[model samples]
Every structure is written in C-alpha cells, then in structure tokens.
Target: MAATGSRMGVVGGSIAGCAAAVAGIRAGAEVTVYERSDGELRGRGLGIVIPPPLHRRLVGTGYLDAAMPTAPVATRVWLTRVPGERSAREFARQPSAVTPCNWGLLWQSLRSAASGARHHRGLPVLSVGHDGDGGALVRTAGGEESYDIVVGADGHGSLTRRVLAPDLRASPAGYAVWRGTLPVDASAEHLGALQLLRTSWVTIGFPGGHGIFYLIPRGGDAGPDERLLAYAIYATPPEDAPDGAGHVRWLADEHFPQEWADIVARGEHAAMTCHPVVDLHAPVAADPPFLLAGDAAGVTRPHTASGAVKALQDALCLEEALRTSPTPAGALRRYARERTPEGARLVELGRRLGRAQVELTPDWAAMDQGSVDAWCRATLAGTSSYLYADTD
Candidate 1:
C-alpha cells in the first residue's frame, strides 16, 4: 500500500495534478501541488465528451453541478468535405443516449472542487532527486522540499519525466492540428437547440484530410445565447508551420485546393492555434518511489480527443493500486503494469486515425468510412470500460 503517514508532492497544477492531489488527500496523505503558473490556467477549446458513468461519479463526489446546463446529447456525427462535395459525405450515428459538455466547463468544475487543496503557484520545479533514504527531494523556484512520494502530473513536456524517464521521447505523428473556437451569431441556421445540443459534425476534405467542428453549450441556467462555440482541427504535416498570416492563408496558399478556400476563410484570423500531433510510447519504470501519471507518462493524439480521458484513467488506476498494494514500491509497479496496456493501445489507435486522415490517394471513401466506424466502436467500448472501472 502507499506508505502510511507520508506526505505527497504533486508537480503541475492542471487537471491531472489537481485530481492526483485530491486522490492522495483522500488516501490520508498530506498533499501539496507545485504549479509553474502564478495564476489560473484558462483557454478556449472544443467540448469534451464525459461518459455518463464518470459524470455520475463526479456529481456524487460534488465535483460537478448536479443540474448544470449541458449541450444536447450527441446522436449523430456528420462527416463531409468542404464545398458540398456529394462524393465526400460520411456519417456516424451514435445512440441518442450519449451526452457531451464543454471542455472549459469541466475544467472549471474540477478547479472549483480542488479549492481546498494546498497549492504553491509560480513555483516551477527545477529538479527532482532522492533524499538518499526513502523520501524524494524536489527543488523548486522557491527552495527545496522533501516528500515520501512524488507524483508527476505535469503535461507532455514534464520535468519529472525528464529527470526520471529521460529516454521516453515524444515522436511527432506526422500531422499537425490547428484548432480554434468561433462564435455563432443569432441568425446562424445551424444554431438550433437540437442541432447545437446533440449533433456533433466532422467535415473531411477529400484528399486533403479531415476537419472536425462541434458546438458546446456554456453558462448555466441562462442557456446558450449569441455565443455558441465552434472548433475545428485540420491536418497538416509537422514541418509545415503556418506563419502569422493565419491558418486559412496557410491552407489556401500551401495545402488546400481552390475549392476548399471558402470553407477555410470562415475561420477568424485571431482564433486559430497550432499544435503538433504527438504521443509517447509508454515509459519504462525509472524509479521506485516516484511515479508518472497523465500525459507525463504517455499521450494520446487529439484526433481521439482522449488525452483527458487517459489522464483521468491514470489517476483512478494509481489511486486503486496505492490503496490495495502491500508496499509503496509495489503499488507503483502495479500502477505501471495496469496502465501500460491501455496507454499503448490508445497510442496505436491515435496514430492510425491520424495516418488515415493524412494519407491521400488510397480509396478515400472506403478508408474514411472504415476509420469512422472503428473509432465510434472503440470509443464506445473504451468509455464503457472506463466508467465501469471508475465506479467499481
């Protein structure tokens, strides 16, 4: 089991860090979070789909509002190409039971729930090493501190991972994603409650790859108004970084065909953000007393949009191992073994999906449809398993 009467230090203050702190606290360990940022972390992004089982647990634990305003259930995912290309249409219809929510809203709820935890903001970790006996030492901007256990909840570029698992490298998955949220005006035809609530859309350009757009409802009780959030991720190679002119310009000038220029033009210049699609193979265990969790251990491409899900899974699995194992080192080992399979599977799936989107000239229709079906089935199964594991 986790060493009793021990203090735990969590590095990084995002979702994974916060969740780890909470779990550690609940397991009867004193926990402290060392955050690199001095203030709150905020960003606008696409909505996140929360599995019903996980959502129920968050509600029961008071981490989410019992009756918070949420977007309509996502019953259909429409896939199409730009410029009304009839030959490029594809669709995946999900059961009417699934629900989706804004990613920002979920973060807000998690942040609020972690208000009571001890947080040291603006204190970036400089180094982490053993204290020569059983405890670990973490050097931060402020000073050095020791703890019985150290948790690396930092993101993909984790400092702890660098110190511990130096060989675990993130390889670019050959494609880059440009994502942004656009405002929906009142007169917009696609802004109906049912459409906005339950229908998620993905438009894949023929030969050029895919673009996904979805609507997420924000604000409680007041209901979604003039501001409906729309986000899209377009595929591009890693070496093709767009300049300040905007993604639309980059697409029109460098990548996209003339027919898709108008669709690219719809995005606002200031809203576009670029990110490389990257994931790491599961790392070998580096140390016995320290452990990796969340993206620090491994990452899933945004194509699956399961980065958050995998991080949450790491937290839950680590919590279980820590609670049940006979020793602290044993718990860490078990955590790694339990998590490696799922992490590797997600990595493989993400890369395959990304590859399918980027590779052109290979029977696009058959390839695209097959990918969508496989994704839907895999997502549903993963969600069910995650929810069951979390609640069990």
Candidate 2:
C-alpha cells in the first residue's frame, strides 16, 4: 500500500473522528483516535437522515454495517395549520426519500469499523498544529505526538481548522431548533397520525418557523419495524420563552394543528435538546499536515440534513485519496480539493433553507402546489439538493 508507513492521528473520536480513523486504516495507515468521553457514546440518541444512495455507499464501503437498522420514507409532506382545525393543510408532497437512522447506531457502526486504530478515551485534544517540517502535531495532557497527517473532527469549535482559517466564525441565523425523539410505543394516542410517518415525513409550518417530523430507528436490537418518532421544530424564542421542552409546547399550542400539536407537545420524549441555528465554513479543508472533516470543516443549518452524510462522504474521499495519491501531501491536497467546495455549497444551501423557512417566511396558508414549487425553485436558486424532488 502506498500509505503503509503513514501515521494518522484523529482528534475528537465521535462520528467524524471514528470515520476518519476507519479511512486511515483502510488506506494502510496506522491510526490513533482521541475521545474526550470515557463512557459509551451510544446513549445520547439523536436522529439523522441521509440519502439512500449515500447509505448504500457507506454500507458497501464498510463504513456502516449492512444490518444496521433504518427507517426509510419516500415522500416529504408539507403541512400548514388551518384556523380552528384539528389537522394541518397539506402544502406540498415532494418525492424526497431518505433513510433515517439512529445516531448512536450509525456511530457504533463507524466506531466498529475503526477499531483497528488505537483509541484514547477521556482524553481531550488541547491543540493541533503542524511542526516545522509540515508533520501534524496533536497536543494533549500526556504530551504531543507528531503524525504524517492529522484529521480534525472536533466539531464546530475545532483547533485543527484554526490552523488554516483562523478568521472564519460561525454566524447565527437568528433562530433555534428543538430536537426531540420518542419511542414509537409511547405515542399510542398519535398512532393514527403516525401512520403517515411510515411512508412519509411531515413538515408542519407556522407563522414563525416550521417543524419536521419523521421516524428513525431506535437503538439496540430494535429492527426496522420498531422505530422512534423524531421531530425538529425551528422557531425564534420569545423573550419569556420557557425551557427547551416548554418552549416546544408553547409554540405548538399557538401555531400547530390540534392533532399535530398534541403529538409533539404531549409525547414523552426519550431524548430532547435545543440547538441554536448557525452556519460556518472554513476557507479551506486542508493545509498540508492538518485536515478537517465534518463540522470542523463546516457547519450548516440542520435544515440541510446533510451533516452525517457529509462526514461519511469525507471518510470515503480520504480513503480514495490516500489509496490513489503518491504521497501524504498529495492525498491531503486531493481530499481538500474535493471537499472544500462541497462544504461551501452546503453552507449556502442551509442559509437559503433557513431564510425561506424561518427568517423570511411566506404566508404558507396562501401557498398552493404551483406557488410552493415556485417558492422552492427560487429558494434553491439552481442548487441541487437531495431534500427536494424536481417540481418542473
């Protein structure tokens, strides 16, 4: 192997780090992973979606296990609440198919694939930079290690990215999202409505923002048949907004349909959290020894649903780069050239979605099928996305 003697060090051993380690191992490089958390990372359960083609590619590339559970839906149903109605008005049904998977399950698969790499648990990376000779260095409490290449998956605040683009920063989009998930068994009362989730994901739009609902698999041995109901509500918080969960219910009661409101506001969630919507893109993906992956390279709004997809693709790209390139520097350059433009594209698309769905929202009630299609075409502005079907 061309990379037989290369040494790769990965910082932040979450999904991105683990995937990077897997890429290095597959490329014949000796790898090490640093994880800040000592405990199992499978407990924080979140939901993420990816295109079916990407999912198949990951499984084929051995980044994911073929048996990992997933809940796939074919259509995206956009809904708007009618005044004094128990249900929402369907705005648009796009042929947006996706394979939604359990975040923990996806991470576990990648981590397993990366087990060949030495893993350091409970150790945080304090800093990352290049040595005088262009070898990347990772600094920790134990000491510093020099590697042929360093992969940064340290998330939105990455030390590795700082080495290349220090001036870049994440700018807020002036809204937030309430992320929550509930076991399917617990949502007995909403079973009728949930039937729609089996084949479609729904978007309930209100005056301020919108809520997207879908079903993703639960962790453990739960098969595709057993799933978790997931929802992400994006809206601006009021001055007197309640806590995360409270705020979700507050907005639902006022804006969502009676049935939809009860589904999100009354369900017992297995996990819930709030995240401020922000977008960031690094000027470059690699500066020789230091390479950034996942959020370390860019962070788009959740509206894109490409966060996990991008990380997995980054790993695949790294594997190909190292396998084909003549030298480590060549590999880094190749990976950066392929991914940098993609990061910028995703950031731009995220901002467009955020602006149309939240910031400069239109009167959803007045929008019919033709109007929705026109609005969507303008929002996309010629950018192709997996989330929307061709309306023309």
Candidate 3:
C-alpha cells in the first residue's frame, strides 16, 4: 500500500463512509469518521442488491460471509404491470445472479470492519478547505483538523458537495419516492420465508412510474418462522417542491394506485419517508485528491436500485487505485477516470428504465413486460463492462 499518510478524515458515517474507512484502514491508514448524528446508525432498509464485483470485494475483505446468514440469495426477478382493474402482464422467474442482503446487516459488517477507526458522533462539518500543499482542512462542530486526504461519503445533500460544486444544484426528476417498512404479516401473500428472502417484486403503474416491494430476513439466528421485514418504494409526483413531509402525504393520497392503496394507507401505520429523486448532470471530480462518491457524486433512479451497488463499487475502485498508483493525486485521478464513465452509463440506463415504465403507449402491457425481460437479461449477462482495473 502507498504511504499517503496515516491520518485521514471521512465525513459521514453511513454505508459509504464506513466502507471508505475500512478500505483506508486496510491500506495502513489511521482513519476517523465524523457523523453529524449523535448515535450509532441502525440502518433500516429491507435489502440492497450487490453486483458480482462488489459482492466479491466484500467477501474477500471479510465484510460478508461466503453464504448470507440472514438474507437469501436473490436468483430471480418478477415484474408486473397493473392496467385497468386487472393485472396487465407479469414476467416471472427471470434468471439473475444478483445477491441481495439486508441493509442493516451489511452496515453492521462494514462497521465491524472499521472497528479500530475513530467514529465521532454529533460532529457536523461546518466547512472544508484545501491548502496550497494539497492537504485538506476540515472544520466541524468539534473543532478543526487537517488530513492528507478528505473523503465525502456524506450523502445526496452533502456539505462537501455544496462546498466543491457550489453552483451545482439538485433538480427534481418531476417525481418523489415514498419508502417504508411493513411487517411481514401485513399481507398474507407476503408471509412465506421464500417470498421474503432475496426476491424483488415490482409492479409498474399506468403512468411512467413503478412501485417495488421486497423482503429481507432480520437477525442471523432468526428462524424461517421469524418475521421478515418488508420495504417498498413508490415513484409519485412531487406535491410541494422538495419538502419531505408534503411529498410523503402526496404519495400516500394521490400517487399510489388502487392495488397498492392498502400499502399506501398503511403508510401512517409505519414510518413513511419521502425524498425527491434527483441526479447530477455528471459525476463531479474535484482536485486536491478530494472526490465525491455514491449519491454525493450522482444518483440513479431507484427504479434500477443501482445506487447502493455503485457506491460500493466506488469505494472498491478507489481502494484499488490508491493501492497501485504512484501518488495520492494520481490515485484520485485514476479513480475518477475509472468510475465516471460507469456512473454516467448507469444513470442513463436508469433514466431509460424509468421512461420505459412511465411512458408506454399502445401494447403497453407487452412493451412493459419486454422491457423488464430485457433489463433482467442484460444485468444478469454481466454485459456492462467494468471500466476500472481488474485488480482482484
């Protein structure tokens, strides 16, 4: 590993930040993660699909088990469309190799890997500056610290992003997402273990949008009879600009269709969360060895569920570049070169997928099914070439 320096600071202690800290520590760096919140993050999501490359990296790093102990392996996908009062079309059992894991479990694994690294809660970064010598200076509520490199894994509304790309702004994709977790027993059809483990059930609406519901098992020791967690994301029109509360109500009242009305109605029963779907024009690469990763760089529509995978990939690629490059700046440049194109590609694919769902015309049912089939086929075939070096 290149000796850039031992002292490093990572802003944000979420999944991306934890992953970056683990990578830095493995590379012989002393890392400290600053989280704005005051407590340990108990990540609460059903599951996230991990692509082959990322899965391999996590397993190799001992962040993941050879076989998932909680969530089942997702080998197939099912897509359906609701037209009128009936099911328009359904595509089932499409072969796929993607593995989905409970988000909370994955976060725990990464947090464990980053055990030695210092994690400071309730320390929100106020500002960041880069010195003429290329070192990063971060000012947080706790005080000030200088680091050889500063990583921004904060999230979509990253303060780091605002400082770097002051002019860049997030424009709504004319839609918002409503997300929540429901009990497994909420729906009789959703009760079985096989149904709850590692499977994604998606339903496209009449307009150019869709709803996805999936399940992931909870505790590692929990039996098949244990309650499975259910999560859903529905794309709906924004109600009042980017106000989170307003969007949540809009999704609950207006956007959801009759079939899913019950789930939407249960929104009040559970914690309903909403956020506007936004993506940058392109991935922004900064100088001074600082760069944006994950949602901070760019976001893909949840229709593809590729955001988490891309973030993990970014961390892996950055780790590999730092390990092989001659200098820190060179490593950062290489990481950008490798990831930017893929990020652009995935964003484009997500847009296309969203449009295919929301903008169907005649033979809409068949068209939707065909689009779903093609997407599953392409993703499963591993046709999307990896732009980064094959370090593994």
lDDT of each prediction vs. the true structure? 0.62, 0.88, 0.62
Predicted candidate 2 versus true structure: per-residue lDDT over 1-392, tens digit per residue? 55677999998888889999999999999999998889978876599999999999889888899989999888988898896676778878888889999999999989999999999999998988777887988899999999999998989998888889888889988889999998887787876668889999998889889999999888876766788899999999865763457888989998998877887788888989988889999988987888899999999899999887898889999999999999999999999999999999999999999999999889988988888889989999999789885654
Candidate 3's TM-score reads: 0.81
Off by over 4 Å in 2: 240-243
lDDT of candidate 3 over 1-392, digit per residue (tens) = 66356467888887888888887777777799988978767655556756566677688876555554444344444444444553224444443445556676777778888887899888898887785567788898667888877888888888777766878776656666666665555654523323534354344343445555555555446563344444445455544465455544444344444444555454333345666676663455445457677777778777666787777777777778778877767777887788878777777766655555543312434554456555544443443422111111
What's every prediction's RMSD, in angstroms?
Answer: 4.9, 1.4, 4.9
- Best model per TM-score: 2
Rank order (by TM-score, best first): 2, 3, 1
Candidate 2 lands at a TM-score of 0.97
| Cα lDDT for residue 347, candidate 1 | 82
lDDT of 1 at 178: 69
The TM-score between candidate 1 and the true structure equals: 0.81
Candidate that beats the other on TM-score, 1 or 2, i.e. the better one: 2
